[model samples]
Target: MELHALLSYTFFLLFLFVIAGETVWANEEDRKVANGGFRPTKLFVFGDSYSDTGNNPKSLASSWKTPYGVTFPGKPAGRYSDGRILTDYVARFMGIKSPLPYQWKKYGENKLQYGINFACGGTGVFDTGNMQPNMSTQIGFLEGLIKQTVYTKRDLDSSLALVTVSGNDYGAYTASGGPEQGLPSFISRVVNQMGINLKRIHDMGVRKVVVTALQPVGCLPKQTIFSSYQQCNETDNSAATLHNQLLQQAVTTLNNSTKGSSFLVLDLFSSFNTVLKNKGDFTGSLKFDTPLKPCCVGKKGDANCGSLDENGKALYTVCNEPGSTFFWDSLHPSEAGWRAVYLTLRSSLNQIYN
Candidate 1:
């Protein structure tokens, strides 16, 4: 082989080695977490699809279909990704198994040690087009448990709460023919309601609450499809900026009013954009071949993430390797993408429990 081809072959070999070894390295990280003596022993989760772990009804949700959980656990586990969603990793960081999904929590009474996940996919801060419970209702589930004394005052004092609201309300707004001119006002309303939700949860006695800033909705494959997934829409990103700005103010005010630093905002927009700009720089162990394109896509533009055919065959095409893709579908990230973003948010996660 020529000199350049020889180097290309060498890099190819190393990439394969990393691919083979990545699973073992991930397992080792989990084992270390098991013995790491983390402070928070429990985690309570709320909000929409990003943090939802099987809370959406499997029979009606596409997330329970094939290939959704093809990576982690080797089967569909109702997470909105190929493998673990944000809930799983956040729980793992705190040295606990992910809390049971709200729809199934009652069945596993003994599994509430890590707190419960009340998040439902495709739902939002307010009631969206779907019938799934909104943010306040999600919190109501936790409050009901508290009222029944399922979690004593000590559990509430020792627990951490995670809140995620990924742009589903805006999506619903557009879908419902709500005009573009009205978006800013609607975003403000969303944040105000979210602030109320945060305060209500805090009042209910959760020790610490973490609210995630909106992810760059423009950067998602749904919006990127207009650019062939090659470029992001800056106008949409600007909207996200405004949303985060107001959210930061709200969170700051909440923390100032509460005892200690009771509220923190996870800067998902900044960290997600950073990951796109400098892929895998923190770990240097994995590389995404196409950061914008999804790992799984329908043959046509209209199909959902894990769509299937009448014959039970896959109607969508999957990339050769999901572990190298940042997105799994039009809306959600692959397991690898969440892992990368978690690594970027390591400092923020540390700030919450410590």
Candidate 2:
């Protein structure tokens, strides 16, 4: 009887251990699924400057210069603004580090797990203006990786993508003598190409894709400087609204056609407007007395922000505090400005996570 009692006690202890182990394992699995799991071990990015975390060549971009990265990392790490960009913030939200630039092949093995960013500043889907790789060629780079077996089917199944098609294509259109009268038609073409690019990315096996809608262009410092950066041109925002509406329709159609409705749109319009309305937040990073005003400007319209003379003298002047301004230069947002926009996107990301 004594031997039997001892044996029963041992079995009871074993049962408790099994239950505890199962609980821990279940919790881990829940976390993985909630954070998008191991399937997407990488994030493949393609877009313009808004998401370009240093894919542009050093010789070509002034982002490699000083004072561009004075805020966060305390050094120029190739990010366009004072610190992190949309890609970096999104990567953090997805529980992964921002990937290396595709051009930086030297760090390939070390950064392979996170994926790559192929975005080049001043690029668009149609190649309407800039000489950089169009959306298709950017995907070609991804295809080259696959051909080399750098990423497998399983990797893609678990991977996600962020595509940004800022208004560069439209800007290019206007620069190339495309008439304002044909702006609506050109906008449609841009969205159509973007939709095609989305389909191509999905077809290439990325499980989820998030794209940004155009921000308020007229509100950009370059455009609103005429109004002293204190007001947003409703005319430009109206154009953005029309573009976003068409983009929404495109996304809906893509979702209906795709296997799992994987396409998501990040609304930059509302996000930018939110911060502009609030002036600044608790951090005091953006104290925009004149929100549309850019921190740097050319002295005599000789060059835009980041311009340097033959002797390397700066042609533009910076404001007292870049953190106090919404527009970084004439085109992009300050880091603080992007952070404000990121706050507004929290809910949209939640949809993707769910």
- The CA lDDT of each predicted structure is 0.80, 0.75
lDDT per residue, candidate 2, 1-354, as tens digits?
001111111111111111101121212211123332233557889988888877777787867776676665666667777767888767665556678888887544566777889998888887855577878899889988988988888888888899988788888888889888899998998899889999898898888888888898878887888887667788888888889989989998999997765888888887788778877643455567777777767766658767888999988787778777777778888877776777667657645543
Give lDDT for model 2: 0.75
Residues 106-163, model 1: lDDT tens digits: 6445668768889999999988978999999999999899988899898898889999
Q: How many Å off is the CA of 113 in candidate 1?
A: 1.3
Error of 2 at 313 (Å): 1.8
Regions of candidate 2 where Cα sits further than 4 Å from its true position: 1-40, 107-109, 281-287
Q: In order, what is each prediction's RMSD in angstroms? A: 8.8, 11.2
Q: Residue 11 in model 1: shift from native, Å?
A: 38
Which pairs, if any, clash in model 2?
39-158, 40-158, 40-159
Colliding residue pairs in candidate 1: none
Per-candidate TM-score against the hidden true structure: 0.88, 0.85
